[model samples]
Target: MRVLMRVAAGVLILLLIAAVGFFALAWKGEIEPVAAVDRAQFDQELIEQGARLAAVGNCIACHTVPGQPAFAGGLALPTPFGTIYSTNITPDPETGIGKWSEEAFQRAMREGVDREGNHLYPAFPYDHYTRVTDEDNRALYAFLMTRQPVNSTAPENELPFPYNMRMILAGWKLLFFEEGAYHPDTAQSEEWNRGAYLAEGLGHCGACHSPRNRFGAIDPERHFGGGEAEGWQAYAINTESPAPIPWDQESLAFYLRQGWHEHHGVSRGPMAEVTGNLGLLPDSDIAAIATYVASVMGEPDAERQARAEALLAEVSQSQSPALVDAAPAAAAQPGSAQGDGAAIYAGACAGCHDGSRPQPFGGLPFSLSTAVNAPNPQNIVNVVLYGLPPADGEATSVMPAFGGVLNDEQVADLLAYMRERFSDAPAWENLVELVARTRSGEHKVAIRPSDGIERGPENVGASGGAED
Candidate 1:
């Protein structure tokens, strides 16, 4: 009995010592709050620059609910662990960052702490924000402070025990978070370096594009190798990009600026919001981002380039004035399961997708669809069911919802047909289950319009809406 008691006491002592050390390491001192500064004090040019940076960061999308005032918070961000509500960033004295000084704001951006020194949840993406420069933070502060003060409080986070504990985040930081501003690559061009800075810091593109580990931190081994965001797959912006037509810098920039590419369909889901926001930035910045992303993706191999060339040629030939609006090619037998999907496609989809009309309005050919060619069918499923909606006051792509029209089995069948007919990749499994889950809201889908503002004739269909 005495020996057992000694062992328990020793274990208890070790645990207590570890606890003391943890508190010592995690503890942070609160900064003194300052009075709200007048908006007039900040320069107009600095505020404008901040606006562009905020757009790049996509701060408004996460911070504002659809109907609420911008940056007033209360946006519910769903995570694997739980839903975390974004805090009000407006300058309201009672409920917002009105009391937070420039130093406090900078600390929050750099270290993920609040004015009171409370550790913030990683749902805020501070893990990426930590790379932001002090100068950028100042600009952001100026922009945020100048906004109309809104009295709002975010709902309490719905995290479970241990995960909800903020002190635990200190350990997470130690494990994954690397604090520092972006360092330029001396070997790369000035544009590439600038792109790297914006993309790695304010853009926080990897937060969605990269897969996460069991602990919810980004997995370094497969960075930008594709991951999920709000139920949509952020396709690999790296060499593993599943786009049948490999993206070059020109295409990427055009897509980023105009929100659509003739070779690649319009941006929908969360990406639509990104493109919409990126419109605030200058063309040079957009080009820089494209340059950097293309470098990361690297050049396609000779085989891939040849294949893409072949596809482009085939599509080009098909779109000739003589062949335009011709009947679609025949499919599987009428009574078979594949035939059911083919019949549905002919009735519902072929009119637009068979390369009859111009693009940014007409549906893209399945051959050029990244969603169809992707490893998973989640995006294609989402698109088929929810469909794209028109952007308000803008000429954009529009597709009607089939969720109410098609049953889960039917949707699965259609997807299977598309998979077999359009892509050489393996067939998707459990598509019926996926369709059902997405339809029932068990897998929440964030459907947004393909809201790219049209940029005139230059921005229209590439290769004149060719079919591949």
Candidate 2:
């Protein structure tokens, strides 16, 4: 018995020592100050470099609120726990990063620790920012310094118990964060490498596109395979994406630059913000991104292609030609229900979306659209309630929120008209319910057609309208 006790005591001592050593290492990992960049280094060239980096990073999409100073930061991002507000990134002495030394910034960017050694929530997208080159980091820092300082103290995040604890983030980081700069692929072209660096590092596209684990850390195994943010379904950018229409490089580039296309889908929800920002980048940079994305496709497998084709054919065949022709004829006659819908469409929707003028940033036209033909009208109803804003880098086209302007009945009537006139699907009856659910913030738009019931033409006329 005595020998056993002694053995247990020895094991206990060893365990205590290990625990102490582990904590000591963690403590040592706290934020450290670094050498400051000389004021002389803050030149126009550096600022320009920073601007380019910012474009790649798409900083304004998250940092700038509508009608607010660029990068001043007041965007409210919702998560599973609660809402977290973006901080003031401007170089204000009190509210922003004015006092942070270059080393402090580097630690935050690479190690996910703030200047005060507080473990920053990964909501800042620092996981992907960890891959940014030091030079680019320096340039980004310089550029941030040049912005006008705003005295905005962000609201405290309303996260649940353990998540609110900053120290716990250290453990999360230990599992996911890797300290390093982007290493160019020797085998890929210079353009591809550049695209990779921008996409993975400063751009941090994976922050939204990549799926996350239960712990909220991105699942590296399923990189860019779709995720959620701010109640919006951020779809996968991978080649294997189940989008009804496959995204070619040209269409992707056009969508990124413009915001919409005929063959590809339109940007709505969070993607609208991304496209708005990407639209501002140089054409050459956009082309580079396009080229890199194109390289990802090496002819989809025959089975997948066959399945997609079969699905499309099935959807096409499902519509009745006689009903499709008769529905429009009924809509054309004055005093008919379709006529009421037409009047609503002309009065409420025709001001901006008539497809006659080229949409700013080459936005897709709404006339005779598949989105309109959808059986589920929830997306359309939601859009009519909350108008979509143009993405950060794209052409400016603000769809005004009609939540206040149109009541539930008006929205439903308008949608009914559009569907009957433009499509052959059944009318949507769940529109009012969908609007209530969406307005109450109960549901979000689905990312893929497979995720929910396909919206049909009849439902399109019944539900509401498309905004994105």
Candidate closest to the true structure, highest TM-score: 1
Mind giving the per-residue lDDT tens digits that candidate 1 earns over 37-110? Answer: 88898999999988999999999999999879999999888887678999999999889999999999999998
C-alpha root-mean-square deviation, candidate 2: 10.3
lDDT of 1: 0.83
CA lDDT, every model vs. true structure? 0.83, 0.64
What digit string (tens of lDDT, one per residue) describes model 2 on residues 141-238? 99888788788887788875545666656565666677788898899989888777777887787888788865567888887777765555556667
Error of 1 at 242 (Å): 0.5
In model 1, the worst 10-residue window by lDDT is: 459-468
lDDT of the structure predicted as candidate 2: 0.64
Q: Positional deviation of 70 in candidate 2, in angstroms?
A: 3.1
TM for candidate 1 is 0.91
